[model samples]
Target: MQAFDNNLTSVIKSLKSSYGLAFFNNLTLQLHQLINADYTFIAKIDKERYISQTISLVAKGKIGDNFEYSLNDTPCADVSDDSVCIYPERICQLYPNDQLLIDMKIEGYLGTPLHDSNGEVIGLIVALYESTIINSEKIVALFELFSGRISAEIEREDKEKKLTELNLSLEDKVNERTTELSSALDRLRFTQDKLIEQEKMASLGNLVAGVAHEINTPLGVAVLCGSNIEDALEKLNSKVKSNSLKKSELEHLISILNQSEKSLSFNLTRAANLVDNFKEMAVGINTDDLMSINVHLWLNSLIGSLRPMLHKKSITIELLVDKNPPNFITCPAKMSQVITNIISNSAAHAFEANDDISDHQVIISAKVCSDILSIKISDNGKGMTDEVKDNIFEPFYTTKRGEGGTGLGLSIVHNLIINNLSGKLEVESTVGQGTSFNLEFPSLI
Candidate 1:
């Protein structure tokens, strides 16, 4: 046992400073010298083909080229069959068909099968001599000691190769998934843009509809006044033809004609003003058409145009400003849009649960201090939660989801104020108290 330990320790040290193939080659050389053999070699078996391939070879202390050969009728055949085989001398005589042994003039042979971690025969180690193998038991001990080391190297290489293949497969899968996601994102963006443009066109349609709806009242009144005048004139013609017209009756007829004329003039003028206001609000809405405006007068007209919608719901909207407010420079179309959307938002969303008509009121007021014009639109109706207020300015955000609410009204207002008009908008709300929007812009644009 002591001799065996000394031999094992010396053998391990000889190959300890090397790795992989170098370690294998060094071990073969060391084994060749340690046992004083003419030839030393290590070979792996191809079980399916019944063949042996040398990984390391040595002849008389010199490393030589490795080669492959059939394992049939050779001493290595028994070794690969999981047996330690030794012929003390005349190995060629024992097996005549082993041509390599005869050519090398080999007389003795000693070999042992190498086992993997599972103890399955994988390979063999061999030493040959021209003379009888002396100290055969010592050589057997040396081979047995180091067979595990070589087997471990082979197992490690197998694991590393498998890991590399797995990594390459994983990388390919990740790249393919990334490409799929990128394509999906592009399609989603295109669809979203199309939807937004459609909504914008729908909003314009609604604007035209609101204007037409509001104008109906005054135009209907004008038609009624014209009919009244025609009826009065028919009566006057008959009275004149008969020459029975009294002075008092003639005076009353004059008064009636004058009143009908004035009423007709007033309502027609009102319809024209509504048309002008609609044209002002909707024209150049997509462009930066900047101009100066009288704060109070502009607010009053814009509110008047929006009144039909509010009055339809019995909601009253009022404008408040200093009597002599300063003129403000801004994009009239964008400012009008911002105010219109806010008032429309209040009318649709606020005052929903309130049963009192008096409580359904919106106040729009404007003022300028230190060249910054601030406009506030507030409603005395159902307000919002903190969560809703936080995301109110985000595009397509709305509490009213499905009942014909596009959720783009306030978002459009936000973009108009910030992107086009170069201004800022802020909001305040409590769940039931009400909501207020403060729109501020530089008085000089």
Candidate 2:
């Protein structure tokens, strides 16, 4: 009993300080010396495969290397099933066909099953001798005492290995997902920029088409008047060449010439005025430079250029500017784009629900108060609901998504007003009443 207690204390001390095959071999060696056994081993048993792996082995008073063998016809297999097995003096009487036992001349055998926390047999500890063991019970007791500790160590190592593999797998998945999300965000930004560029081009195309349409009328009139004047001059030259001129005939020719001159001059002046307005609009839309501009004069020219487009929709636009509104020093191109997007948006959406074309009106009024410039553009058409108003400025959000509305018009307008022009924009609307956009900006930016 004293020897058994001392052996247990020594094994516990060694196990607490060290680990791995060396620790297991040292433990088996200590057990072998204590019992005076010729052979001692600790084996892990795979019950399903009927295999035993020798974790630590000792023989002939020396430590032996670990190995594995079939457990089909071995005493270790029986020890795995039963808690303890002892063969004090077998002498080839039991399991005579067991070649390992015959070859090693092992007569005395004692083993204890190593059980895990769940009380399931997982391994065995065994001792064998060339002669019969005088104290078989003591050997079995010693094997049983340390079997649980060995099982615990094996289970702990297995769990730690699985946990390490799981942690590595989790980290890999997290990194992969993060990379995918970053790539997706980059793609989204690229697509957004492309869409914005497309919207700008489309707006410019519309403006060009409108200006072309507006210029056609006066140009046509001027051409007609010039043709008539040329025909009248040719007839007068023929009369002078013939040397047959009456006073009444000369007076009639002069009256006809006077009317033709006035018609030609009026039509030419109209054409020139239209051309000037279009030129100003084109310059404003293309240039980004900041310049001092008369608020009233600029608005008048912009409205004149847009009249052709408004007329096509049967929409009337009225502009009321203060007598002494302060001039603004800012980028006219960006402001023009902002205003154009707003009016275009109204023409496309605000009047779609209203059937009355006679009353369709867009009123633009501007005033200067202290250092601020305020512009109000209001429409007398079906207004918006709270939901539409809230998300109106959000990119890619629109009510007319399918019918050629890119939903970027208002988003561009908002960005231009806030980001480029450094101005503020607000909208007021009720479902049945009307819609009004209020714009305010510094006189100098």
Candidate with the greatest TM-score versus the true structure? 2
Per-prediction TM-score? 0.70, 0.79
For residues 1-445, write the lDDT of model 1, one tens digit per residue. Answer: 5865686578788777777678889899988877889999988888999999988999889999999999899889889999998787989999899999999899999998888899988889999999997788878877888889887776676678798998999988999999999999899778767766666666566567778887898999999999999998998999999999999989998898999999999999999988887776777766777777778777876776677778766888878899778777788777877787788888888876445545688998889778788999999878898888888877778788888676777877887788776788889898777899988998545
- Candidate 2 wrong stretches, greater than 4 Å: 13-111, 116-120, 125-136, 244-288, 353-358, 369-371, 443-445
lDDT of each structure?
A: 0.83, 0.81
Clashes of each: 0, 0
How far residue 53's Cα lies from its native spot in candidate 2, in Å, is 5.0
> Cα deviation of 392 in candidate 2 (Å)?
1.3
Instruction: Score candidate 2 by lDDT.
Output: 0.81
Tens digit of per-residue lDDT, candidate 2, span 232-335: 78888988999887778888878877887887788778778767765665675656777777788777777776777677668899999976667777776777
